[model samples]
Target: MKIGLYFGTFNPVHVGHVILANHMLHHTALDEIWMVVTPHNPHKKKHTLLDNHHRLEMVYKATEEYDHIHPSDIEFKLTQPNYTINTLVHLSEKFPQHEFAIMMGEDNLRSFHKWKNYEMILQDYDVFVYPRIAENQEEVILKSHPKVHLIQAPIVDISSTLIRKSIQDKKSVQHLLAPKVWSYIDLMNFYQ
Candidate 1:
């Protein structure tokens, strides 16, 4: 089976995420796309992130009805300051039956060279890159790589940061999230 691994904090799973995952599943040869919920991103500030469990639950609520998309907490058991290379290596060893491909935005691909053992990652795994509004040099790099493929997924400008700020400001987010997730966030008073 070929699986696309879409890694993110999922601070609170939003509609844009769901759309992107669905797009990957429908457009690519991938069997499924896992929304790998990272507990903490080494590159990001820890204080700005919500609790891992909360983020995971939101992902669950958002993905419950989907058969192709799954919420993964695989990173929770891994060591802190988790690097993508290490995670990919561990996943490859543990799930040898499935071929894993890295799913990422063009923006991240722009800085991919800075990642730990990025060269090895590019050589070993296929990368499914989605377009971002921002112009980046990574597009040129990815275009030249045999293992990288650009996917035409609908780009939504909505972001987790914007959703969180809207909630903090007591604004409506009905359009930004699934009803189940939005209700859960309202009940828990998250992001306030």
Candidate 2:
């Protein structure tokens, strides 16, 4: 089985995430997409992040109904300040039968060289990159490495940071997230 590992903090799983996952499944050769819920992304700020378990639960709740989409808590038990190379190595060793690939945005491609063991990642695994609204499409395509492939997905501007800010301001996030996920956030008082 070929799986696309879409790793993220997912402070709150929103509709944009679902859309991208769906788009990838529909367009790519990937059999399934695991939404790898990272406890702590080394590059992101920890202060604004919700609890790891809460973020994982939100991803689980949001993806439960979709057979092709799965929420993974693989990073929770791993070392803190999660590194992509380490996570990929662990997953590959654990699931030797399944071929794993990295799923990310074109914006991330610009900074791919900065990641730990980046050259090893480029050589060992396939990276499927989807377009981001703010990134230059031509620049990303021109800069792509041998392992990288560009995918055209619907560009939804919604982000977890924006969603968190909306919640903090007591603003409506009705259209930002899925109905069930939004309900869960309200019921759990997440971000409040």
Candidate 3:
């Protein structure tokens, strides 16, 4: 099986994420796109993030209807400051039959070099990159990388930060999130 790992904090799963994952499954050679819910991102502030369990639950709620795209909690059991290379190595060993590739936005490609064991990641696994609203770093980094694939996807101008702000302001976010996920968030009084 070929899987595209779309790793993120998914602070709260939104429509943009769902659309991108769907696009990857249909447009790419991937059999499935796993929304890997990172428990903690070393680069991000922990105070602003929702609990790992809540974020993972929201991911599951948001992606439950899409059979081709599933939510993963693989990072929950791993140590803090989880690195992509470490996760990839572990996934490869546990699921040797599956071919895994990293799925990310072009914006992330801009800072790819700053990641731990970045060279090893590029050498060992394929990177499937989708475009962002104003992304310009892809060409710079992928100019000579054979394993990096640039995928053209619609750029949705939405972010978890915006969603959280909307919720705090008591604004409607019906179009931003899945119905179930939105209901769950409201029921649990998250990001309020």
lDDT of 3 at 157: 82
Score candidate 1 by TM-score against the native: 0.96
For residues 1-118, write the lDDT of model 3, one tens digit per residue.
9999999999898999999999999999999999999988998899989998899899899988888888888888788888999999999998999999999988888788888998
Off by over 4 Å in 3: 135-139
- Report how far off residue 173 is in candidate 3 (Å): 1.0
TM-score to true structure, per model: 0.96, 0.94, 0.96
Lowest summed lDDT across 10 adjacent residues in model 2 is found at: 135-144
lDDT of 1 by residue, 2-43 (tens): 999999999888999999999999999999998999988888
lDDT of 3: 0.90
Tens-place lDDT per residue, model 2, 1-192, is: 999999888888899998899898889989999999988777787887888888888898889999999999998989898799999999999999999998998788877878899889988998998888764554553355778888888877888888888998999997988888899899988887
lDDT of the structure predicted as candidate 1:
0.90
Candidate ranking (TM-score, best to worst)? 1, 3, 2
Which of candidates 2 and 3 is the stronger one according to lDDT?
A: 3
Task: Report lDDT per candidate.
Answer: 0.90, 0.87, 0.90
lDDT of 3 at 13: 88
The total number of steric clashes, by the backbone 3 Å criterion, in model 1 comes to 0
